[model samples]
Target: MSGYFIYASLHQGRPALEIVDADSRQVCLQWEYGHSASQQTLPERDNPAVDELSESEIQRLFRRLLLLSCRQSLHGQDEPEQNS
Candidate 1:
């Protein structure tokens, strides 16, 4: 994974989050609830005809991504080693 991009939007009339991997161009995560309203900030608020996120929103996204990374790291440590 090179980098990540996270955005908030409405999915089926409900707020949702979409996280994508920049290198693989694959979605890594999606959260529909349990997050604060800050996660719902629209990307257009800071961009013109482009999806741009505000500074605070970007910070929140990065924080969430970091937390997710830490959690995944912990899980990875729990896995048994595999011999090729």
Candidate 2:
């Protein structure tokens, strides 16, 4: 079976995301958004052309990251308005 896994956490105090192959545990992609993204990044010592993804794919990934970040930020907060 073909599968994959995604993980997100802080790396050196910066936001880090990784996509790994389930079978080989190889990281297919790694992104560190940091405080801002001023340049494009590619897998270390790897050709970016071979791993190029569509624009939509990148957008979708960004959306997921935003959602996850929001969730993490709200992890300990209380929403009294929702109680009503």
Candidate 3:
């Protein structure tokens, strides 16, 4: 039988998820959501809007980042609301 597990990743200190399968002597897996997103068949960048942004967009991103920093706790954990 197969088992599923949801783990809150602590590597990148960002929004991350992991699902592990269990049913064999040695089984492990990680669906790297973006191993090479930049190499996608389409021309769109991984984060197209961020990669190609105007002055206003850049400022907006900075503002958001600042807001997030403020909401983050001492444990490096940010409130769910501040996460993407």
Work out the TM-score per prediction.
0.39, 0.38, 0.29
Report the C-alpha lDDT of model 3 over 1-84, residue by residue, as the tens digit.
434454655444332344444434332333222223443222345656534433344455456446534543443444353556
Scored by CA lDDT, what does every candidate get?
Answer: 0.62, 0.57, 0.41
Model 2 C-alpha lDDT per residue in residues 1-84, reported as the tens digit of each score: 334588989866556778775667887667664223533543343655524433444665678667645653575333333555
lDDT of 2: 0.57
- What order do you get sorting by TM-score, best first? 1, 2, 3
Number of the top lDDT candidate: 1
| Sliding window of 10 residues with minimal summed lDDT for model 3 | 27-36
Name the lDDT value of residue 83 in candidate 2. Answer: 50
RMSD of each: 9.1, 12.8, 14.1
- Tell me how many clashing residue pairs each candidate has: 0, 0, 0
Model 1 ranges with Cα > 4 A deviation: 34-67, 71-84
Q: Give me the overall lDDT of model 1.
A: 0.62
**Candidate 3 accuracy as lDDT:** 0.41
